[model samples]
Target chain A: MSRKLLETEGPKWVAQGIITAEQQQRLTALYPEEGRVVGLLPLLGSLLVGLSALSLIAANWQGLPELVRLLLLLGSMGGAYAAGEYFLRRGANDSLGIGLVGLGLILFGAGIVLTSQMYQLIGYDVTGLLAWAAAGAALTFLYQSRFLFALTVCIGGIVQGYSTGQLSGFSYFTAALTVGGLGWYWWRRPDAVLGGVLASGILWQAGLLISFLHAKITWFFIPAMLVYAAGDWQPDRPAGRALQAPPLVAAFLFTFGLALYGETDTYAGLLRPPLLAYLSALLAVLALSAAGKRARGRLGSLTDWLLLLPGFYLPSGLALAVATLVVLYAYSGAVLWRAQQEHNPDRITLGITLFILTTMAAYFKLTWAFMDKSLFFLCGGALLLGLSWYLRRAAARALPPKSE
Target chain B: MATPLPLARRHRLVLLAVAVQALFIIGVAAAGYATTAWGRTITLRTAPVDPRDLLYGDYVRLHYTISQLPRRLWRETNREARPNEPVYVVLQPAHGAYEALGVYASKPAIEPRQAVLRGWITNSWRHGLRIRYGLERYYVPEGEGRKLEKRPVLLVKVSIAPWGQARITAVNALAK
Candidate 1:
């Protein structure tokens, strides 16, 4: 129904004879053919007005009494909400209504702060931030507004950070709340800004996951690999709840894992639990992804799937690591192939980005062994140029013909 | 699926939403009013570090002088107070002002002017118990807060409510 869906897939379906040209036209027309919206203007105006209003209070005009200041803060907050509701009731200019709600939310928080300052009130900022975030999130649920949800998530992270002592003392309950709340919210409304939920989940995971890994740093990669595998697993094709945001989470996790790997050059730590843990977890993820594909009978044959997942039961950790990386590479290659087959531009874009990240990480990581700076740069430059040309030509050849 | 509320029903919910937010603001004011109207006023020495928090706009991070309470200063108590738990501190007359006489894990029944106040047990060492009444941080105007930081000792006016919760009402800088 979106413009991107029509533009990218319409021609592909037409070429493949999936739908008649007339049926395509009718299907596309079913969506409202709205022009680009001017929603940003009202939102921008409201932000400017909100900032100036808060700034006016900040000036602390001596003549204004404390009671009057409190009244002004309350009056403006109530007025904004009332107006926002009235505008929504009209069922026109919804952006303006949303903007008003945002305004009211901001002012409401500012009121708590201003009153705190006015009376020199006591309490940690966490107390107020949590309250503000809760109120904002409630509004988001009430209205199903993604923007306000995004706003609340940002504040909620602050609450998490402060409560846990800059996340140094992040408690188990906090981690559970972050994962649980985001998971529930996404399940209820997957379409509402996935950005916030992903961010909160990652902040909680990375903060807690890496915190426990003092020396066993590479183990951090498993959670992300699990996320990617979760997304990559689907019976018919690569899809599921994992497909929504886990791939992106996984790719970044892969990048971080590589960065962590690159930080070390020791051979001693390679056989440890972190490594063994990572290898086993990586195999489990690979097996899960392969199992889904195997069930659907998409990956050619059972032997082929066996080739993709090699040495899963291997006694040595090193062999398992090698097999896991091979499986990872195969899965990414499958993602690219599937993206091309389905004409899923988003998947293709993500695949390409991950490839570039992995390649760059490898290049820098390998070059780190060079003793002399000049030698490192010389080898790195050559590697970059070679990989650049090779990747460019491969990409060009992989694209669909322009005739389509 | 959520059935759409009737128009009148929607209006009432919206009003309720606004009222809830309004009530939060009034709650803050109500606390302030209670302190000013019925609570006793006391002054304590204070110091400032950072002057601004980007999230909450302008405010100074205040560190009160009473933050460090010696463990020996604690009177005969029923039990040891845990770290970061709200405990009542009994303030007695000391050096033209008041200092903590004893820190209790729970609120202690007190005389009319015994001055029982609520404070978090920041820490307790063999030497002393570090207590921070939530009134430690005093919010002030932008550049103005920075000016207060220069003074070695700034007098902080605290209004303690009938219920023991304290609020910093004012900060007075000492001129050299």
Candidate 2:
């Protein structure tokens, strides 16, 4: 049976030739047919690590002082390093690095939390801040993990820069320099790229949030565009399936940011400027999306419409604009249902699209709908329930019973 | 043009660096907490200071208790106030070194008869330190003092460092 299976796949493997005989041998040895259960270990390890992190965050039985808790967090980093070393000795791959880097992240988070808890702990020299920054950079280097390093550096930069009253786009630009430099250094490794993406997102959020707090309106739109650019830049690269999600997620976020700003502001408020600029900006995005060379069909269509949504703010267009989104979402759901029935397209992809559209419509109707929130919620719930039931049936029909 | 380091070596270095940084951050935090004996660090839920500013919208103008000072008294200490002037005060610690219990504004205060008498500010300084943030500001008009007489006053009692820098020793908040 093994021989037959190998014979069938061997030709394809040979034709592809991406995996050499030695690599194939290694794969087979690691996941021998009878003992393939061992491969589950990494998945199990990852789950445990994830759970521990959750537990650490969720624990409410508070006793330790903030400083003591921070010290314990530092100790946990030691444990992570030890775990990484053990994994290495046992010949594990980058997942070990990922886990260790996660520990570093937790520590960094703890540091930030502790500072806030300890009062406006200020007056640290640039050299002092850089010490922690260097440590964060070191974690990246140790794991060859650019993501954690980039994250550390970005947060450190924000803390340092913000404290000194010296934050700007130029600062963000400088931070991005690290992403390119370190990202390029780890070019062969996807983890590094992943790191860059995360770092960039954090920095973007930080800048936007700070700007929001300061009532600095101009920089508000930067994050939205940054997310859009991230999405636009992806799909061209050889990013893995996991990494592919972020760009699309970023795109959605960009649209949401625009919608949120637009819907929240009163028409006469000065804050409306950011919302207006965002609306115009979305027009350009819509045009680019229509240019159509990029990822086509549903994603592009949804994005284009999403960008156009801010036009809802126009008093004359408000009713029509909301109705359009609702209709589009309903149609997408119908299409997804049809796609599932035909077994010709990605059902989950269409379902997600339906979800986003539905959520957006609900948000607008609930917030912008004059004094009839209950009615809007009722309709939204009914639609969601109907879609869910339809999906269940479609899912049941598509997936057949498996034989052991 | 940097050569890509081997994954193993890179991983080791990154781990070490993160660990070290984490240690240093914790240390800094501990040090900050310890210094509370010099002055209290307080975060208030605040509202807008300018009544007209509130009329424009609902956001608040946040001010730190530490930043609050009798302007005339502060000016008098430095003689003439520059755009960025440094003022020092002595404090008593009620808790840790970082926590402030109360403060004595050492700068001279203006009096009708005394003219510019160098008087140490104490109870009045604590009253000024209670510059409210958040909903508290909303409830009180700009000219009005805190409505409740026994309101919680956040004070980090502190002493001056050798170089006349503020060093917190204790934090005392009036019980609700």
Candidate 3:
């Protein structure tokens, strides 16, 4: 309500000269909701198409014939252009719709050109990947879809860090930049999809960074703490109030806690980052949840379970592995719970990443151990089954009970 | 609410621009590649000099093959060699492609029977090619001068042509 008022009120204020031209531009560009039908159409359409394209690209990894892949990538852009033309001719060129479709085509085309050119040069080297990704991001800025823009840039940063053979430093930097920069940008305007994109990138990037950069755990907490502090003041809009802040706060605090427990550091100040991060995130999410519990009379969102990740970590090797399994289970549980609550794709993705990471970690652990490999396998298998059962129970419990 | 921008058109334009640029760059690269691989090239043998880079590592900056003035061009000019003087050289028979001819001094005021080659010589005791201008030295890899074996190895002559064009021709390798 207040958020809606604030958003509608903002443009008027700017028109009245209350806001500077640049501020007005930035704010308006941050969240464009015009082109009602067309705007809505492409965003929905692109969601499916984009996902398919991404899956296909990922699936062909390592096995893709370079020449054929290049041609297909380029051809995809051409198809997108034709689609855009059709939309334009069909009178879907409303400002918002045009912007959305334009953005989609731009992304599709840029993705093709860059993928081919970059693959040609470095065979998917870090520099080329980052460059192409940055180019796509630049397109995002032009199209004013920070959600996609932020995602591309974050992925680019991760690829760059991966290229450097270290996931911690570069990934952290890119994640922080993408998350914090876009987070702050969208926070002012508070678009749901854009905010979700920012949060997702931060979660994955931070998770990956922590997994790699265990040497300094405290540094991970800085942004988490900042995000928590920022999420304190709830925005008036539905997009900002209910969706964006809560999950971000939960994920950050959870990751920070995990960083504190799992990462080994001798420095006395090492734990402060995670401590501060977790506390702030906890405060923000709890504050939001309390508001809903008090006023809305609804159960707390399962996103709060992100906090369990940090709390479950243990120092003992066997205990730590068990706790990791627990955290992964909790992560999946929270995603499923959120999916049931909101029926959003974001939740689905969170669930998927949790499953993938869990499977990868278990595989790595099982394959690397020397003696007692059988025990490792047995225990890991037991944990997987146990977690699967727990998740199934959690999902079943989340459902409304059937009448006896 | 305003109408959305037609994304497809904008995307096509963007792709077109990128593709054009890529094609242009590749074309230039191909041309250079062809010239290096198949085209006739005269080698200028030279010795290596030292150069340093702050960020990247140091390298031995190599000198050229035709490092000195041709004796025939020098004697025919009838002008005594002077120190710190610029010279100009011209190719008599134009090669199939652009080629670097050795350096000489100024052209004669009166038309001579033969081309007045103005090759300059330093007043140094060794009577060798002087390092008058080093920024323009063209270098090729060592032992790649099989084509230049028939032609006289011209000295590293620096010339100021009639149109103020400066060229160094007849490059020879410095004796190690």
Q: For each candidate, give its TM-score against the true structure.
A: 0.65, 0.48, 0.35
Candidate 3 per-residue lDDT, tens place, B6-72, comes to 6676566556644643343344333333433443323333333332210121112333333354444
Better of 2 and 3 by lDDT: 3
Give the docking tier of candidate 3. Answer: incorrect
How would you encode candidate 2's per-residue C-alpha lDDT over A1-404 as one tens digit per residue? 37546646765786799677776666556544653468778779988997897587535213345555665666666667666666755665666656665665665655554443343443422334445455555556555555565566565555546433421223433344345444443444544356346545444545555553565443344444443344334433333323334444444454444434444435324333466666676566555544432553334234334333444345433444455455456545655655565564465566646665656555665555464778767866787677677666666666555545
Model 2, residue A68: distance off in Å is 12
Compute DockQ for each candidate against the true complex.
Answer: 0.33, 0.14, 0.02
- TM-score of candidate 1 on Cα atoms, chains taken together: 0.65
Candidate structures ordered by TM-score, highest first? 1, 2, 3
Best of the two (1, 3) by lDDT = 1
Candidate 3's residue-wise lDDT over A26-128, tens digit each? 7766665555687578779978998998887755543565445555555555455446446545654544444544454455435533443322211212333
Query: Which segments of candidate 1 are over 4 A away from where they belong?
Result: A1-55, A61-63, A124-127, A165-185, A195-251, A254-346, A371-375, A395-403, B1-8, B35-43, B46-63, B68-92, B100-155, B160-164, B170-176
Model 1, total clashes: 4
CAPRI rating of model 1: acceptable
What are the runs in model 3 whose C-alpha is more than 4 Å off? A1-79, A82-86, A93-120, A123-125, A145-173, A216-222, A241-404, B1-176
